[model samples]
Target: MKKNLLVFFCLISVQIIVSQIRNVDGSLGRIPRRGSDSIPDNEISVKLSGKTKYTDYKIISHKNDTTIIDTTLTIQKEYKFNFLRKDNFELLEFHNQGQTFTNLGYDFTNISPFPDIGFRAKMFNYFHIEDVNYYQVPTPTTEIMYRTGMEQGQVLDALFTTNFSKRFNVALAYKGIRSLGKYRRSLASTGNFRVSFRYETPKGQYTIKGHAANQDFFHQENGGLTPTALEAFINDDPNFNSNRARMDVNLSNAESTLDAKRLYFEHTFKLLSSKDSVTQKDFSNLKLGHSFTRDSKFFRFNQGAPTTGVFGEVITSSGIDDKTAYIAYNNELFLDFNSKYVLGKFRVKTMLSNYRYGYENLQNSTVGITKNKLKGNAVSLGADWNGRIGNFHINASGMLTPGSGRLSGNSFKGEAFYKKDSVFTIKSNVEISNRFPNFNFLLHQSSYDAYNWENNFVQEGTRTLGGSIASKWGDASIALTNISNYTYFDENSKPVQFSGDVNYLKLKVSKEFSVGKFALDNTVMYQKVANGDSVFRVPEIVTRNTLYYTDEWFKGNPLLVQIGTTFKYFTKYKANAYDPLLAEFRLQNETEIGYPTVDVFFNARVRRTRIYFKADNISSFVLKKNYFSAPNYPYRDFVIRFGLVWNWFI
Candidate 1:
């Protein structure tokens, strides 16, 4: 299967290359432009004739922010061209492409006010509703992104969008990956498919948008190397240094899978409009809105045979299979009011939510018979405010559920910002949330005797205040948080909550310097645990630096090239250990693994296509082989790979 997919993609790539060569002077290889007329960077104009500008293609975020399509090549693009298709500065990836990541840092500023199905280790590659994107374009647009995988497979993401009429648009996208890792029982495969649509009435009185998605993730678990195999790996034994498959693993026949599907829609109708043509009317544009969402998820773990030494005794040694499922529905109705007195817009809303999460039937083990499910409904009241005063813009939202139910809690997030041109900007934000622990923490059932549990945990609460500044000099941010009833997995792979308050502080800064055709980009982060370090742990410092040279090559500026190398390092600390059975990370103090890595890259751009070539972890060849992503799990070795991203408009 892996070889077939590789061959298919290679054939398509060759076909596209040939087409580009044949149509360099035609539409296929021509860049989007606004004719030969040049417009000043500070000027804004609308042209009804000639070719369409890149700004005509728009991407709308879940929060209503909009940005135009960008086809430029830069260092930032290099950082984001990965399996996740995003910048992973705060994360450390495992050995394979579709596997999990270890959190180098945490962000508590934006958290949900409701509990979910646990097993966070399996959610790194999963896509939530907020990750989906909508699009609007004057012409049919398509984008294809491909990347080589770790050992035997690759990753591909394709997107297409088009407008049927002046007021209607639709988009379809899919991303799939398969990688047979170098280690035994480490294969990973995943797929994500989504479709989105948007429509508006000709009078601009009604607007509607929605999306549906289906996703699945599957991976084999080996439970890392055994004690003897670990010693040989760290000692740099020449016999097994080049061939990693020869190493012995703890588990040989265990696998885990996660599946999810969602359907969502939101619509708005304007009840009233302005009385005159004035921009600032006393009262104008009253709107009524409704939003609906239904999502379902399932997780399963299977083992043909159990290892008593690794996972403890089991109720039945024949085989083990564990499954958990979750389903939720949310309906929100809101009224929006726009008035000159209020400066901007205000919204009042109420949400009705229903949830069911747990096992399907009762399981009787040596421990006891555990509860099957936690099902209930909740009603929440919410308010949102957005306004601008002089040079400052303020936005805030709050939601509350008064009763003493499992979903009973309150959440609030507010932000204020000031900007003076594009050179200087400052922002401040605050967040507060109180919610119950995940379903697995409250109730769980498994074939293993030690994995079944039932508990009544209290609601966890957290508060945070943060501020950031961005100017021509650089960018900097600082945040401090206080957490109470912090829930986590203990070293024994059991759910536990901290009783005392945990205080944490984080500071980060980034800057770039350029001289001639060379530039250096640096980003550094510092973290400190003021109290309760046992339950909450993080590295003291993490940093990444890149030095690169860029220039236009060839005569007619047919190509643009960038050559660079990046170095990343972090301080050693008590990192967490991963548990495959529950797909969770447990707190541990036994292993402290931290080291520096170097990666070299040569990237170039031609027309609307961007090519990437990278040699990752070159430092591993010269340094000691003591690096580990987690306890007993070694980091990946040196490898070279290449791929490309291309865009087409019709």
Candidate 2:
């Protein structure tokens, strides 16, 4: 571990030295001010004061929200500098990178309208249509992010985007990681590649946008520590404290993998044109659009030799291999009308979807062969409305597929927002949906006798209503949700559904205070399961607090520095146990795991580069050895890590 750390730092040092030699105004040195004295930088720009400004570099989302590029240092940025590259306040990660995370809370508002292929644990790093971004930049833009892994590996995410003309733009990105964990027989490697394009006609009458993505995740599973190993870890034996690889694990040669590929495109053409800009609000226009999508995914599990004690009895002790696949295709056509009479833009769409998911052959074990596949077609109709009234903006969408097929269901979601500049913003939303569980819960196949099953279950229904207030004072949100026919895995790793309805409530608040060079940021969440505690569980309270100092480092303010220490804690609960075979968490009532963690970090920004250095789980050294991410899986130990994010324009 020490040698790997030294080599990683040396590579970073070499890059910094090369950059210094290539440019006198280096990132760590004096940053050149934007003025006429500066020479032409990228070929796309003549001068910094020209029409091409920082705001010209745009990032567009699937919902058509546009945000400009921003390079700044803040505590929020520090929290997002991790494996997932997002704020994981509601998640607890395992000891290694590229591994799975335990759920500390649930958010019903983000549920999907349709069921997925299952294996939610492996999908954390997966990229969906909404997760991809389209770029429109004045010049070629590039961003590179690098981070140190657990023992002998690293992670890198790189992106590059450029505009060929004012009407056409293209972007490419790839993220890959390889991590060899400190534990025995635990290794993870994953990769994702994406390319997107956006184009429009000269008259802006026609537009098209699409992307292609390929991703795969592979992880070697050791199940967890053995009984003797668990005892040694809990007792903090000196012999095994520093040498984790010497410990015993449940499975010696077991692995799991997930692979996926997708292709999508959407095009629109305007039928009515109006050149009157002053009367645009009163003018009417009509547009026609079409979209097509195809997706293929599969999950597989392999074991060299089955362990009867760990996974029950298997059909054969020589070896075990299990695989399942899901393939889907969707086509949609829509018409949009923009008029003053309706007070908003209205759209009506019709979609046809086809799916096939299951194994290639039938199971001949004691479970018996029921069905080999679930293949069918679903037709759906939907409508959307978006507009504003006075100082408020409203958006709503509803979709229905009326039939007795597997995909037949209905969903409706609506939101309203009112904002008063920087003073405050108030928002409210409601979502209701009825959908079937994932494919795994319906049908699964495995070499192990206890892992194969097929069942007919009713559609699960959920409704969530929430509101929030965001202002200079703080940000707070509250939500109430009710669920019927909730499906989950039992302690024995079998699919099950709760008979009664479940009700839950969540409250979250965040605030930051600054005084001079010192600042404190805090976030807290409270949750309650009004009913169905036996089926649903979460910590009663979770909180994170940070106290940091910020200041300009040099005379010319070329460097910005922030140093902080964060403390996080959650109440004890019977957290769900992990099942690597299915990549799912099952119900557990034996042990309760919850504890506090402390992390210290020093972050700095120099021009377009941001550097981070952190000491995670610093309190673990002085605390007890009872910290566990799952039943027998221990949490991360004290370790120091460093990484950086850099951006360049050409």
Model 1 poorest 10 in a row by lDDT = 40-49
Task: List TM-score per model, in order.
Answer: 0.94, 0.93
What is the C-alpha local distance difference test score of each model?
A: 0.86, 0.86
Candidate 2, superposed: residue stretches over 4 Å from native? 1-50, 275-284
lDDT of 1 by residue, 1-650 (tens): 45335544654564455335433234343333322236432222332223555677899988778998777899999999998998999998888889888899999987987888888998887778788888988666778888888888888887777787868989877788888888899999998888999899997789999999998889999999999999999999998988999999999999999999999999999998775346543354699999999999899999998788888878786878899999999999999998756788999999999899989786545687557888888999999999998889999999998787788899999999999989889999999999999888988888887888888899999999999999999999999999999999999889999989999999999999999999999999999999989989899999999999999988866788999999999899989998998899999988998999999999999877899999999999999997888898888999998989988754
lDDT, candidate 2, 548-610, per-residue tens: 999988776778899999999999999999999999999999989999999999999887789
Query: Which parts of model 1 are misplaced by more than 4 Å?
Result: 1-50, 280-284
